[model samples]
Target: MTYPQDPYGQQQPYGQQPPYGQPYQQPGYGQPGYGYGPAMPPQDQGLAIAALVVSIASLVVCTGLLSVIGVIMGHIAHSKAKRGEAGGQGMALAAIIIGYIGVAIIVGLVLVFVIVGIATDWDFD
Candidate 1:
């Protein structure tokens, strides 16, 4: 009976390891080689993050007064991202959305209070 030859065309006697000087090496698994692909560099996301923070603060503490500033910053950040000058476009968009919602809520509440005040006559004596 003839045994199958190894990759180097050598048929070693049944399960004995190769010589110490010529050890068999296994192929690398699940790891990328050096400089395998192009990597994109990171961009600045300061404006986007600041906008998001300020927008959240407006809703939580400032009663929408700072919402307009947040919205402006968000727009600038979003535009920078669109032009490939920055990152965090999603965050900027969320800031803009939240700020606008805050502004709307403030306006709605003012309108409601005005209507209630007009409907009732209180004597200031």
Candidate 2:
């Protein structure tokens, strides 16, 4: 018995491109590569990271001064991120929150000390 031939028997020869549309255009070497989807945002800035570090350290050191500085830096980084001048918005926000908490803790401790000193009638020379 004779076998039937396959449909669309157009076989491309060696080293020959198939009958298709335009070829894929790739980005040049050393050029920024992009995906088929929308472009991604830039990487986070250093100031935001620094703010986070300082705010976290403030809690360990129990110093309100570092907390204040961290809060300031966080604000700056947050603003820049909002304007698209930098990234790390989340980190900056976290830093701000941590800094505020640190400041509150310090203030609460001071109040407690004062209250205890008054209640016990402690005298210092």
Candidate 3:
């Protein structure tokens, strides 16, 4: 800490490198940091989101087909998220629940129809 000290190290000869080597080193070049290892991959959320969308659509479209698709997509999303390859776990769960609900609704309607038809039989002799 002297008054006439040099920050860049003792003055180098004309057109010479400063002491201590290159002033800075690029990262990932074994320079301490700079993504020395595989970069963190972006999470794939398509499955999770698709599951949610299909589940919602099931209520309006083919309750059986769409709901089945939603359930599959949700399972895939959950698997990917578990492997640290995707996001939106909550969305996947919601999709699964909704898909099941859709399936249940369809089943309930069929049962109701059968019950009413049986109850009102004319018993034509």
Candidate 4:
């Protein structure tokens, strides 16, 4: 099969190449002896994403349970980052902090309610 450059002036045939003054271009890995090598595989980000999302949602939704989950996931993600298993250390830390704040808010509200109830002599019975 003849691989002729259709219509266009550039003739990129099978064995033939561009005329002089044109630099030879390799597919992806350039140069000889040294190759670009395979692209780095993406690091696992499940824990990191979960931590951040859960923390943010908890903070906005004011849900203590999700905040706790966020804190747990954050710690796991941070550990993974330390061991070079994953990334997003900053994200994990932020999630942990946010989670703590959410938990604190929840506890604070509970305490406030309890104090108000006792002051008013509210009876559960």
lDDT of 3 by residue, 1-125 (tens): 21121675443334443445445333234446575788887777888999999999998885788988998899889888888888988899999999999989888888998898799993658
Q: List runs of model 2 lying over 4 Å from the truth.
A: 1-41
**Ordered list by TM-score, greatest first:** 2, 1, 4, 3
Candidates 1 and 2 compared: the better one by TM-score is 2
Q: Find the candidate with the highest lDDT and give its number.
A: 2
- Global fold similarity of model 4 (TM-score): 0.66
Which pairs of residues have clashing backbones in candidate 1?
A: none
* TM-score per candidate: 0.67, 0.68, 0.63, 0.66
Counting clashing residue pairs in each candidate, in order, gives 0, 0, 0, 0
lDDT of 4 at 59: 87
Candidate 4, lDDT over the whole model: 0.83
Off by over 4 Å in 1: 1-39, 122-125
Name the runs in model 3 displaced over 4 angstroms.
1-39, 122-125
- Per-residue accuracy of model 1 over 30-122 as CA lDDT, tens digit each: 356787799889889999999999999999875767989999999999999999999999999999999998898888889998888788865
Q: By TM-score, how accurate is candidate 2?
A: 0.68
TM-score, cand. 1: 0.67
Alpha-carbon error at 69 in model 4, in Å? 0.6
lDDT of each: 0.83, 0.84, 0.79, 0.83
Candidate 4 has its poorest 10 consecutive residues by lDDT at: 1-10
Candidate 4 local lDDT, 16-43, one digit each (tens):
6645666555434336664467878788
Q: After superposition, how far is residue 14 of candidate 1 from its true place, in Å?
A: 34
